[model samples]
Target: MNELLEVLRHQAAHFGPELARTAFQRGLAVTKKDGTRQPIPITATPVILEAAEVRRRCELAARLSSAALKMAEAVLGGNSQEVLLGGLSPLERAIAERTWRQVSRLATTRVDFFVGAGQQPRALEVNTTIPAMQGYSDIAARVFLEVVARHFRYPERALASLLTLNGSNALALYRALLDGYAAERPGQMPETIALLCRRHDAQISELQYLAERFREFGADADVVHPEDVSGDDAFIAHGKTYQMVYRHLFVRRLEENPSPWIEDFFGTVPGRKAVFLNPPTSQVEEKVTFALLSQALATPELAEGAQLTPEELEAIRVSVPWTRRFRHGPTGGPMGESLEDLVATVAAEPQRFVLKRSWDYGGKAVFIGRSVGTVPYNERAQALYGAPLPWAELCERAVADPTGGGYVVQELVETSPEPHVLCTETGVLPTSLYVDYSAYASVGLARQPAWGGVCRGSMAEIVNIVGGGGVIPLITAEVAHKLLMAWKAL
Candidate 1:
């Protein structure tokens, strides 16, 4: 562990005074949620899971996400569709009901996991709409491997086989768009592909990187804001007409802030012509998908017979945690028990569960049971609805607001602390961090297998990059040794 710390110190030195922070900020271009670049706070020691184990988790994620997609799609035709999708807003539910033009449920997504003591990987959420951080992950992996190879004698060739690149995600995304176009409009491969997003998106750099990659893969690519596009059935950019367009903004935002461009994109000719990357289906993005999966696991028949296969059901039970849409009625538990009973149980042990919004992202509105004690939890409940009666009142509030914008209560996953040394001004400061493994899922002809993934660490309960935590680059022993020697020489 000390030797590994040595390598991290050396790599940190190589990046200049701030060490990895400088490289991360400039090289990786880590951006905050406010569209400003800041110094990255990366841990020296990376959590190195076995290559096979990483692949297994990734495969599980694919299976779970695919199954959830099918289940969400089933809402359009299923008899219990209304009850099943009661958590989504009417607009989101309506959007989900329609078959998207050429595109399927989730073309590109991400499954976040936390592997704890038993080494069993527990999935936190399925980011089915717009998943970021792949560009950073790709660059971090490359920098670690390349820098280590120059300074250390490691099995570079073998390691390459074992690990996967973040580039696969980019390739998968572009391939999905092109293939969808091919199927819908054969023999007319799109010459230009445009990435359409909001002007102030913090992930602009990532979008730019993907656009550059699309160009590399033999297609003209452009990154433009929503307001940039005008006219009928075509987006005009720099005097060129873009046939294929990738949407990075969510449907909720478009609805909340309606403009001429937004209205045209969702309502008029352009909405039908320009191909959306995600196709505006917000149901898949809802946290209720996990709740549905949890419910299905409890009562397989609740899946409505032929909608989900036994294997798919198994995947849900295996990967997904116990979840339920927070609502204001007498909800049925997985085993047909009353929701009131579940609430009573949760009240007895509030620290074991979490409550969050259904369709939100960036870790907003997440109320961890342990993080916020009984007083704050109740205070939050009271804040939601002017008065606080009891735990039952909160459950009622959740049920009352069962829409696409509803809230969900999920079982809290306990992740084991990963030992890490933070490289700082004085020296290496030892600390323990809770790490999360974020695996990217790409839509393609077959399952796009992922081996290695982006690992982020945080001292706080939440391990999101936006909250000051940063990426961890997994390297070998030889590389660590060289870094130690290099640091000593310095």
Candidate 2:
């Protein structure tokens, strides 16, 4: 874990200018909601992991995501779409329904997990809509390799070999985009794609990088906003026709802010003016899907009429933590332990679980039982419910929110904290931080893409890049050892 950190502390702390230069040219940054830019918080040293372990987590993620895709289809195909997709804002709901029929497959998804002592990738949530960080992960790995090689004066061929040995999520995303585009338009290859997002969307920089990568991969792509797109007999942007429109914007954000061409451009989707990669999917993105997975074994009916294979069910049992819809009704435990009132069970022992809104973003509606007494959680609870209700009251108030599909109670996955060195703008700071692994996947595409992952570490349990958590690059042990040998020989 400290392989790179050890070398940096002892002999290579002088590569900041070059590293920062790579970051700037690569757009390794996040634009704030208020339209300001800042360097993405990251760790100086990548988290060295076993190749087998990375494969295991990604395999688990794929199974779970495939199960989720089937579940979404079953839910949508059944008579009860609103049972899971209700209570959201009108815009969020419309955004979901607009593309509801378009969800035969999920083009891209990133399943998030916290690592445990036994090496269990305890999944917390699944992001089926607008799954990002592909480009960022590539940038981190590529920049680290480039800077380290340049500083140590390694031969160009050695550096090229090292870069080849690593996987690129950007390449994975590009392949997935093409695969999805092909499925949508058979025999029609997409020469150009439009990366869709809000004008000042926080990940605009990342989208820009993705556009650059797409070009390098021999396809033409442009980062564009809704305002620039027009829908005629076909969707057109800047007088050019794109075969695919990759949406990187969130439904909530789209509902909150949109331009004059929003309705017309979005309206073309049902008619297929142009293929929309990963069409809006608020239904599958809701946190309740975890609860459904938790209950799948207990309630076999949840998997009824859906393609929940035995293998996927086994995967859920092993990796997915216990989760349930937070309500006042009776429900069985994840282990089929006993029937208990959902609200009462959580009220008694809040520390064992986490409360989260069925559908919310940026970790704003998450209330961790472990951190209930902490000031930040309390402040957020007080602000939302008009009082810093004890964990019990908090759960009750959350249950009573008239909103449909309200909150979820999830078993707290005790994360194993590890030491890391933050790669801040100024300098590196060594500290122990809780980290989570988020692996990428594609469900319903012709085939799965070569998906790697992104790691974010933080002092708090709720880790998100935009919410102040820094990223830690994931490096295979073999790759790290190779770099170490190269450094030693130098």
Candidate 3:
């Protein structure tokens, strides 16, 4: 552990303090709605995985993606429509009904898992729409691996033989665009692909990176804002017409305010003009989908003649934690008695549950039953739910209230802390943190989905890069083994 810390310190020194400051201020710091900002943590030491473990996660990601796609199809197909779509808001339901004319229900997804005692893997959540940081992982891995090779004098071939190299999400996205084009146009190749974003979006760095990468790979890709494109018969951006538009903004926002821009992009301009990467459907992005999967697992008959097979249902059941989408009452609130019962249950065992919003991202609107102290929990709950009954009641009410439109309660899987040190701007130092095994799965041109992943380490209960958590490049098990051996030999 100490040797790994030393390696990280060396890497941080290589970047220098000036670059770190610039990156943190310009890139890492997240600006909240009230104009408050905080730096995003980054660790030089990476989370290492066994080759078998990498394969297992990849396969698991594929399965989860398949399950989510099936669930979306089931909702769209009217099989248990109310049961599957009941938990979503009106806009979500409307979008879920608009069948993606060209793409899969799930174009891409990220399965976040926590590996507990005896290496039992339990998925926390499935990020079904526009999962970010795929390209970041590739860049991080390249930099870290290069540093490791330089410091230890390892040959390129040896590193290549050990690692699961080439997980460029930018490439995967480009291919997915082509697949959508082929589906819509049939044999006619798309000449230009536009990476669409709202005007003055913060993710300009990522957009530029992906655009250059797409161009490098022989695709005429350009970063264009929605304002730049006119809602004409043909979608034109930057003086060039585009066949496909890769949306970087959330569909939920678009649904809130529908515009000619959206209609033109989605081919609602008389006839279908351009293919939207992730058609404005936020239902698949909601956490309620997990609850639906859990429900389907319990009642196989619910999936009768559905796209999901019995075996797939079983897989989803074991992989996802026990979850339920809380339903609202007729008087515009949670079911009163059921909410009370849920509060009582949380009071009995606070550590077992976590409440999350259906459409929130970046660790916002999350309440971990175990993270708060008894007094604080009650106070927070009371503040949130108009007078807290008890810690348990607070937990229950937290899940019941649809403050953010909808909510879901998930069984909290214990994520044991691992021994590690912080990779800071100053230097490396000891800090115990929990690590989350997260994999990004995308269905591109290939028959089998490709998987790239990141392992986030955080002192906070929720491990996310946005919440002062450090991201480590997830290396193959074999490469990790060799690195361990080398460290020991040293």
lDDT of each: 0.63, 0.77, 0.62
Sequence-dependent TM-score of model 2? 0.94
Question: Which ten contiguous residues of candidate 3 have the minimum total lDDT?
Answer: 328-337
- For model 2, residues 311-426, the per-residue Cα lDDT tens digits are 89988988888898887777876556675587888888777888888887788788988787787797778778877778888887898875647888888888767776666555
The residue ranges of model 1 lying beyond 4 angstroms of the native Cα positions read: 1-6, 9-35, 79-94, 97-105, 151-168, 260-272, 304-306, 327-340, 374-405, 422-429, 443-452, 474-490
Predicted model with the maximum TM-score? 2
Q: Report how far residue 11 has shifted in candidate 2, in Å.
A: 4.5
| Best model number under lDDT | 2
TM per candidate comes to 0.80, 0.94, 0.81
lDDT-superior candidate, 1 or 2: 2
Q: What lDDT tens digits, residue by residue, belong to model 3 across residues 250-275?
A: 65556555655664455331126676
lDDT of 3: 0.62
Compared with the true structure, model 3 gives a TM-score of: 0.81
Q: lDDT per residue, candidate 1, 258-326, as tens digits?
A: 556654554321235665555665555577766777778766676764377677777777777778866
The 10-residue segment with the lowest total lDDT in model 1: 158-167
| Residue pairs that clash (backbone atoms under 3 angstroms), model 3 | 49-477, 50-477, 51-477, 347-392, 382-388
